[model samples]
Target: MSIKSALAKPFAKIIYKKVQKWANNPVDTQKKVFEELIAQGASTAFGQDHDFVSINNHSDFVKRVPVRDYEALKPYVERVVAGEPDVLWKGKPLYFAKTSGTTSGAKYIPLTKESMPNHVEAARNAILLYINETGNAKFVDGKMIFLQGSPELKEQNGIQLGRLSGIVAHYVPKYLQKNRMPSWETNCIDDWETKVDAVVEETLPENMTVISGIPSWVQMYFEKIQQKTGKAVGDVFKNFNLFIFGGVNYEPYRAKFENLIGRKVDSIELYPASEGFFAYQDKQNERGMLLLLNSGIFYEFIKADEFFTENPKRLTIKDVEVGVNYVMIISSNAGLWGYNLGDTIQFTSTKPYRVIVSGRIKHFISAFGEHVIGKEVEQAMQEATEGTDIRVSEFTVAPQITPEEGLPYHEWFIEFENEPQDFSALAKKLDNSLQKQNSYYYDLIVGKVLQPLKINSVKKGGFQAYMKSQGKLGGQNKIPRLSNDRKIVEGIPQ
Candidate 1:
């Protein structure tokens, strides 16, 4: 091992001990974070609005603050965007982690001076814990590549705004700067395909040992390397041993990746979002990522099935049980109050609090774990027929898990008031629109794991007929806009 890896080994041990102290007392650690959040919140506009001064404990908090999605939280976020200070948290956010939303065009999640370190530290600790456990730090000395968005940031008022990964690029620990690749110029390339091309050019000859990104994008990188060198990626970068990824499960693409690399390498899974860096894989052999209890975020859980029900029971960490699906809610120091994070997760272990991402709370199709949600399909459908005379009558989308021909696809059963001039062109529009909105779907499409979506023209009254058959069809009942399986689609009149 070189000097950097040699030094990281001892440092890794110190981090492990510190992490264990909190992990072992999960509930108490969460309580401390909650108290800190409430104490700090008492000084803010939101705290005054919600009567946070009267909140004595968890029960009081739940009563004072109801759960809210981005739309509900927009009022405060708007005030912050307009240069207001202390509207949500103690002060104006240092940066806004911009993300795409369903109803809202763009969302600006706050990163306060206090909460920003949680994201960077959680990522670093994940690697260090691995080093401490396996006695493997050799990868630290070689080149590391994080495939991500353009680091170019825009300023609003006095606060910087960018994609979470782009904002994170500015905060890469000083120690890793020498090992990290490709150059900043390549990282700032805006277009995905163009950036991948530039990254390959810069990284091909380096002593690359660690690669990080969403699995689909990283697969693109692997494929590009093979095309250039006509060799497996592992052979091309003999020292590459670590694959760090988040956002989507790697299982569906594992075989394809291993085939591309010619061998399996150690992998670490992280559960991160624009809202917060929530969890990371602390143990290699573990079933789930360890929930971050001490990261200045207090978490709540509501049973997924009951989330739509009025006044569903909100659960604290101590009340969470293994194997039950729950919508993870959070109140963080970042100024978000009782925010609905849109993720559904199942706890795998309660003692140290570990969870596996299950799916989104409402209208999600994850047959291949791509997490195609209702909003994405709606946006795509709207975009596809925006200026065209062709109008939609009724429609629903479902995953085609096993097609008789080649790879799988999202099957669109659409009833058109006026059909497209060319059916194939319309399908392409739908496919392109969906891919543009969702990065995971884009990756799947480009990686050849899923084909471009296919649209089946439904008989004009098909949706109504299906809805009638299923129920006492009336004003209240309607055809689901999207389903993961073909149950609803199969029943539609052909």
Candidate 2:
């Protein structure tokens, strides 16, 4: 092993033990984080306004602080942005993670001194855990690239503000600086397509071993490399073995990725957001990511089915069950309290507190009351296309409430890399898979309230054209797997 790989083995073990201490005591770990957060929050203006001093337990917290999304909490965030101290947390935030969401405008999530380390450490620990689990530290010795937003940041209220990945870029460990690919200038090239082209050129001659990014963007890179080198990515970088990805599920892109690489590469999934880094895949072979119970954030869950109803009951680590879709709520050291993350997750293992992000709570189709979630649709797609040569490039689902003829149906806009032999048969198989996963959808189809879902073939690059039109063409921007409204997919040609 190279010097770096040799050193990584022992270091990874230490992190594994540290992570295990919290994982083994999941409930207590979270409770302690909760207690510490409440204590710090008591000093903030929001805490004082919400009676945080009186809150001694989760029940008290629940009664005092109701869940609030960005809009509901905007007033306090506005104050913080205008340079107010002791407003949200104990002091002014160290930085603001600027994110694009909520119709109002950009959301500036606080990243305090106390909370920033968790973001850096959680990502570090994920790789360390992988090394410890599989004894695969050799990849650390080779050039690694994380396709991310520009490291360039802007100033806001004397605090740095930028994309989360950009902020995190400043923290890349010194040991890996030489190994990380795509020079700073290439990364700073604001245009994603241009940056990727630059990345392809910069990485082409290196001994690249690890590649990381959202799957869609990475696929673009892979295609670019293939076009220039006229070789499978594996041939271009024979040592490349690990693909670390986040922001979306990888299964849908698995076949296409394997095809691009010309072989399967091990992958690690992470659940990260502008608010906080929550979970990461800790094992080479596992169903879900290891939730960071001992991180600065404390988690809460409410069943997705009842999330829209009056006062949905919140459950802590002690109460969640496997396989149930629950909307994830969080309180964190970043000074966000009772914050609705709007992401739905399902616990795959409660003992070690592992979770898989199922979907965004808002990104689902229930116009016909079937409540088909991202997870269900993804699962259906995976099952339907299994054991087939059909490869999907990108896809999204929207309800077609009005059709030119016949009953209205759910429209699936698919950009296929390799189309199936029979589109009609594929549609039936997809419908069957979805029916097996959701009874309400099954009932709707049986009742003839909705016709069988129809698949619309989107010509190659159609989705890319649509995303580029919206100015969301890369770097953590991805079309939703499904939407309640047709706004997102409306621009797509079908």
Candidate 3:
């Protein structure tokens, strides 16, 4: 075996041991993590405001701290941005992860010394766990390319500010750094098109064995590589064996990716956010990712249906049931107290605690009370396009509430790489698939409350153009699959 593979084997073994232990007693481990966080931050302003000193258990913590979204937590975040010490965590944060927000134009999430390690360690452990479980260490013998945000972090009030992916790039382990592609200089290019061109030049000649990034951006890189080298990705990186991805659902893009790469490679999903690294796909056979219960974050789940209510029923891991969608609330060592990250998830398995991201809470189509979510739309699209001579590059669905010529209906703007033979039949199939997945949608259609869905073919690169306009074209930025309003639909070119 190569020296790199030999070194990775031992590390993977150790991580597997720890992961097995954590899985054995998840609830107790989580409780201990919560207590430690409370004890560590009890002296901070946020801690004192929430009465953390007297909080002795999960129930007490829940009673004391109310769940809040980004808007509600802005005051404390503002203090942190102003360089205030101990406003949330023990001291001023080392950095802030800049992310898009709903109410606010931008959000600056604190990343303290204590919380930063969680992101780094969890990411490392995820890869190690995958290697341990699959017995695949050859990939480590060669370089791995990660398409991420620009690493040129801007200093804001003495704290570094950048995308979470960029911040994490700064902390990649030294050993792995040697095998990581696209030099720091290339990664810092603010313009994605320029950065990708540089990455293609830097990595096309390397002995690359793994590729990791958001699926959309990675797909872009794959296309660029193929265009430049006149070869499929598999041919360019003959030993490539793994593809690590997150930020968006991979199902819809799976077929397109397979065609681009020329062969299927092993893949693992991660649920990482600016807030925390919540879960990772630990087992090859598992359908959902294992929630990181002891990863320095206390978690709570509120039913998605009741999330907008004044007092939604909050449930612990023990109380959550499989198949029910829940909005995840987290109290992390980063000093966020009961902060709702706004992504909805459903537990696929509750024993070892595994979950699939259902959708963003705000990115759903429920105009006529059908309550169609991200997962449902993804599944419908998959079913509708299956076994057809059609390939969709990207798509978004929105309610056309005020149609000039027809009844109110849901309209889908689809950018197809390979158009279907029959557009009318494809639209009918999509509507039928939606009815099968959502009972409420079917009822609405049957009762003549809503018209059949409409399909609008978008010009090639329309979605990309729309994303670029929003300044969200690359890493961690995804087109919302469904929207209640026509913002996304109207923005795309027909």
Best by lDDT: 2
Candidate 1, superposed: residue stretches over 4 Å from native: 365-494
Q: Write the per-residue lDDT of candidate 2 for residues 345-388, one digit (tens) a residue.
A: 99999878889989999999999999999998899899989899
30-138 per-residue lDDT for model 3 (tens digits): 8898889999889999999989889998888878989999999999999989989998899888989999887779999999898899899888888899888887898
Residue pair clashes in candidate 2: none
Query: What TM-score should be assigned to candidate 1?
Result: 0.77
Estimated TM-score for each candidate: 0.77, 0.99, 0.97
Query: Which ten contiguous residues of candidate 2 have the minimum total lDDT?
Result: 98-107
CA-lDDT, candidates in order: 0.85, 0.92, 0.89
Please state the error at residue 147 of candidate 2 in Å. Answer: 0.8
Off by over 4 Å in 3: none
After superposition, the stretches of candidate 2 with alpha carbons farther than 4 Å from their true spots are none
Q: Cα deviation in Å at residue 438, candidate 2?
A: 0.4
In angstroms, the error of model 3 at 179 is 0.9
Q: What is the clash count for each candidate, in the order shown?
A: 0, 0, 0
Q: Could you arrange the candidates by TM-score from highest to lowest? A: 2, 3, 1
Task: Compare candidates 1 and 2 on lDDT and give the better one.
Answer: 2
